[model samples]
Target: MIFAIVGPSGAGKDTLIRGALAARPDLRLVRRVITRPTESGGEDFDGVTPEEFARRQSLGHFALTWEAHGLSYGIPRDQITGPGDVIFNGSRAALPEAAQVFPGLRAILVTAPDILLAVRLAARGRETAQDIRSRLSRASFEMPAGIAFRTVINDASPEIGIARLLAALQPVRA
Candidate 1:
């Protein structure tokens, strides 16, 4: 099955997904495609130039794609086809398109109040304040009121947020 972990930046999306993977080895998380360079100590997609990404997209190499922070991001279709529980960080606006590809995909919206999110983003030191603000404004995380296997969790510490997300997803097991 497919699961998406979505939220504003600094909402602990990566931490939650990592913890869930650790707790559930059966989960095979999808890797994303990115145009930005990966940070020295963070997990991210291998960077590819925009031209290369465009070529691949034209070749139908991505399941879903979006642009953020002046870079292009994509989730490869092959990654989504794998077995076991799957988790991905993605845009909520793209959920419907993803659902078209994987009918049973579920979305978990990880959200926090703006002030906290701002602090968290600042602490990361990876983005300028203006960039963070722009991302926050442009990023989408709204899911329709009612949808199966979909839920929301408030932003807290990584472990805390992840635990909440885990709790939210546990009941949907087949």
Candidate 2:
């Protein structure tokens, strides 16, 4: 099963994913390829130039690709094959295409309140004030229909959020 972790910025998706990984070593985390600089840290991902990203995408290297926030994100075709339970940070808008590619895809929506989101985003220091506002504005993006999903409200401590996420993932464990 492929678990697509979807949420708004600053929802602590990376934190929860790291905790879950430590707890369950059997689960595989897909390292996504994004067109953002590696130094612009958030989650651990392979950052590449737009030209490089386009080159790879054109070579039939990506199983899934989507554009968001003026950047291109791709999930390499090799990463999802022969996996145990796979997980990757994914876009909400790309869920439909993801489902079409990986039929048994399960979406894990991590979320927090708007106030917490604003604070978290600011603390990260990855985006400008205008960019942060732009992200916050889309916090309420609705989930598309016809996808199996579980929601984990990351509104508390890291420990609590990880516990909730693990609980949500229990049923889907291989």
Candidate 3:
């Protein structure tokens, strides 16, 4: 199964995914292809430019790619070949196309109140105020409707929030 976890910037997405991986050794995670420069201590990735990304996409290098915040994000189909279930925390904007390519796909859209989101962004010390504001202005995340998402976790209480997400993976009772 493919599980795509997405939320706005500063929504504790990378943190939650890392924590979940530590807790659940059985889970598999996919690193994304990005145009953004690699930052210290951030998730690992190969940097591709818009032109290179477009060239590669034409060659079918990506299972999916999307434009957002003046950057390109991609998920290569090659990585989705293994049997283990996959987990990725990325842009919701990447979902529409990504889901269609991978069978058994699901989404987990993480979100918090706007005020809380800003606070989290500030705490990260990664983005300038202007950059953060531009990201927030994208308004890319909202409750995903009609998608077979496992669950939506509020980051207010992260420990319990992750537990709820893990629980949602289990078979539901009638």
Candidate 4:
């Protein structure tokens, strides 16, 4: 089974994934390739130039790809293959397509209140005030129909959020 971690920015998706991985070493993480510089620093992902990204996509190197916030993100086709359960940070808007690509794809929607989201985004220091507002505006996206999903409300501390994620993923563990 593959788990697609989807959520708005600043919802602590990366943090929860890290904590879950620490506790559940058997779960595999798919390192995504993005068109943003590596030093941008939020999640651990490979940064590639747009040309390189397009080239790889043309070569059929990606299992899935989507564009968001003016950046391109891709999950390598090879990474989705293996013996264990896999997980990747994915876009909420791409859930429908993801479900088609990987049958039995379970989505974990990490979320927080708008107020908390604003605070968290501001704290990141990576986006301008206007950019933060832009992100917050599109935060509340409805999950597409016909997809199996679980929600993790990351409204508390990081430890608590991670615990919630672990609990949600418990039943799916192999």
Candidate 3 TM-score, true structure as reference: 0.84
State the TM-score for model 1: 0.86
TM-score of each: 0.86, 0.96, 0.84, 0.96
**Per-prediction backbone clash count:** 0, 0, 0, 0
List the candidate 4 regions with Cα displacement exceeding 4 Å.
172-174
Query: Candidate 3: lDDT over CA atoms?
Result: 0.73
Tens digit of per-residue lDDT, candidate 1, span 11-121? 777777888889889888778888876663345666888999999999999988987657788999888765677788887666777777778777788877777778878
Count of clashing pairs, candidate 4: 0
Q: lDDT score of model 1?
A: 0.76
Which parts of model 2 are misplaced by more than 4 Å?
172-174
List, residue by residue over 19-59, the lDDT tens digit for candidate 2: 99999998999999999999898889999999999999999
Q: Residue-wise lDDT of candidate 3 within 53-108, one digit each (tens)?
A: 78888999888777777778888878777876778866676666666677667787
lDDT of each: 0.76, 0.93, 0.73, 0.93
- Model 4 is weakest, by summed lDDT over 10 consecutive residues, at 165-174
Provide the lDDT at 112 for model 2: 98
